[model samples]
Target: MTQRICGQVVRVEGPAFRVRGTDGTEWHGVVRGRLKKGKRTATAPVCIGDEVEVTPLSEGQAVIERVLPRRTCLVRRTPLGGRRTHGKAPPVQVLAANVDVVVIVVPAPAVRSTVIDRFLQVASSGGVQPVLCVNKMDLVPEPAARQHVAEVVTPYIRSGIPVVLTSAATRQGVDELAALLRGNLVAFIGPSGAGKTSLLNALCPGLDLRTREVDARGRGRHTTTTSAIYDIGGALVVDTPGLREVAFALDEKDAGDPLLLFEDIAGLAARSRFQDCSHVHEPGCAVKAAVACGELDEARYREYLRLRRALERSPSD
Candidate 1:
């Protein structure tokens, strides 16, 4: 007789899910009814990294009867701008679910805070931990580049968010990065060409994932089209492709939901003044204060404010 068990979804395709149970086997399971009824969302519900309950029907078949409440999730608006989203952007796209840490990889100093900050906002809403990992440290070892990274990423670091400078080429911070992700499920997210795939290859040699060069025109050719789960020994990382969507969330209704992610920002933002404060211009904004007092990166602060304003003007927000 087959056994029933709870599993964490490592991958999702259509309504089928690739889940890993505590028994250490990957199973193909379909969602149960009650779980779907609860969400009632426009976008298809199941996402990579979801924790669910599965009952075996046969050797390779199982039914997903329920989705155990997710401790964290990363969500975004759909690509097409629409009014259907109510006050903010329309529909939430869950890149991955139930992740413990969100590892944001970006280029040193040149890393755009607007993108990172927006990511922070999404993660904060999901109740996940965020870490800034600066890749290509080899290119920025000298004065200008190195100083730029320091100035830009300081804010996140000051917020108790771990910031690690790394070089996938020289293997500079690979060990440290691996150690940090050891025994935890970390979700790697960033724009194209940030060296996330390269870093993954470094951590688990011979994995050989495809990558591209950044164009002279300054735009990165998007790679890693879909989200994938990579397991390196004891550490498992969920690698998400570049975010093609630009929708904002409504009213921060999920603000208090533990299922939502982004604890780092929420923890700090809660101390800020104004219950509805967007963390942009409100007096006594702790987020801004961190930037002004050299506790946060100015570039990050500016970008965070920009996203804040965008969210403010966004539909349903």
Candidate 2:
């Protein structure tokens, strides 16, 4: 009888995978040809955090026979030639599987609301909880400047997303972030120089993940070239390569109302007089009314409209 065991994919590199078996052994495995040839929607059939059944062939070697169903997955639309696809809908690329929380790390004093909203949509659409992690808080030493950064993320906090202010240099909020991630599979995703690796090091001492400083232009240099999962104090954490842009993985059916992710906008929409109010230019539009009365954050409303417009535009358009 052949020895078959269950394992979770910890890292993927081209055609090779590192799977950690239930018996506490790490096996270098590759997917079976039949499994690779099967119909799939994602750009890759295997991703980090995927559970698979493996047949051990020899020491430290195995063949991945099947992939178990994912409880949750984080995905984004594949870019065309390094840009958003215009004509045909882009295929989805699965970033990680079985993710419980996605930590969107951003540097202080450089918070981009639009980018944060895009990441929120991706997490919400993928059935994963989103947490905003504002890293490098120590850079803003002055109280006024630090307050400004806090104000920038207040909209997200109001929308029920947990926001953690962390400074790897000062070890601030690292414990809070770790508590939030305890006992869950979390993925750290953000643009380069956001200190994802540094935070991981703080959480699990002596891990010593390589990190680089921001470039002269203030952009992060990519240090993590591939996605890999680490076992940290009973929690499984995945650190992924920095992303320059994030586009929603949506087909016609999956591209329904984007407002579902924007709780603040949705709440206002519920009060609109018209049951099908477009909110762009409609009579008794609660969303616009709130914006006019200064009850709603203008920036948040603008981002919501931008996302809605993007979704409304057809692929061919």
Candidate 3:
């Protein structure tokens, strides 16, 4: 029997994966049959940030024998809007495993609170910390642009979430962002045009992560096609393909509470007249009262409601 070594998967493309050991050695390997035969929670048996046991074969090649248990995992459903997978049940896609922090990157002047809320739900549900990074701020220095970005992200800030305004172009907030991600396994996730790759390059200098410009229709061209991991100043960063949308796979019993992200609303919920109040039509709803009385921003409350509806309609439900 060949000696087995413990390693962490840095990337997975098709059936092959790149695993890095503690000694800084790397191996290219294919998943062994046992992993394929066993039941898997996600579409891919191995994902970026997974720890596994590898068996060396010859040269630089090896075989992934076993997958270690994951402490945290960010999961989502397959892309159903674009290409059809032939009526097959959408397999769960694990974006990253064992992540300490999830960095949601959004381009300034074009940020969408709904999208950010969805990512926050995933991070919160997965039991990991989430940091919202607004990139390309330098490109949108106009007061109107600043206002738009501020309006979209203010609720999250008020809810105790850390929001970093960064500009990869001008190096604005780059150091601050890097400090936050240091000494942890951070997964960088965002929409296609959100400047994720560019930001990584800015932080690490020579990462050379590919980047592209948004089209005239305000849609970003896909720059990253696969998930990969990199080391940036001792931090393990997992970079994933650009996501056009994040569809939740939450179970009804495990659906994340949007109000939980809102400190004020969550605190008021405890005082609702009905323990099971949905906060929409029930009387004596403290949440509703707060919104009506301007104690809480109505727009923020509405976004919370929108997130709740999305979770309720999750495919897993």
Give the alpha-carbon lDDT of every model.
0.73, 0.86, 0.85
**Regions of model 2 farther than 4 Å from truth:** 1-3, 82-88, 290-299, 313-317
Instruction: Assess candidate 2 and give its lDDT.
Output: 0.86
- Candidate 1 lDDT by residue in tens digits, 1-317: 55668888877656777878888887788877766777555475578887777898877778887667777778777766545644543567777887888888887646766667767766676667888889988877679778877877776675677888898899998988888898988898776777888999999999998888878965567777666678885788998786634354433565323212323455667778786666656997776676678765576555555555565566553
Clash counts for the predictions, in order = 21, 0, 0
How does each model score on TM-score? 0.78, 0.90, 0.92
Tens digit of per-residue lDDT, candidate 3, span 1-317: 78899999998887789999889889998999878888765677888899999998987789999889899989877776744455554666889999999999988868888788777877877777999999999989789889989988888887888899999999999999999999999999988899999999998998898888999998889988878889897788999988888877564566555665666788889999999888889999999999999988888788878877876666553
Off by over 4 Å in 1: 1-3, 13-16, 32-39, 81-89, 215-217, 244-246, 254-307
Per-residue lDDT tens digits for candidate 2, residues 1-317, read: 79679999999877899999877899999999988788876778889999999999999999999999999989987764544445645568889999999999988868777678778878988889999999999888889988888777987887899999998889999999989998999999987888899999988999999988889999999989878998886788998988877777754555758786788898889999999897889899999999999999887787778878877763521
- The collision pairs in model 2 are none
The global Cα lDDT (0 to 1) of model 1 is: 0.73
**Span of ten consecutive residues with least summed lDDT in model 2:** 80-89
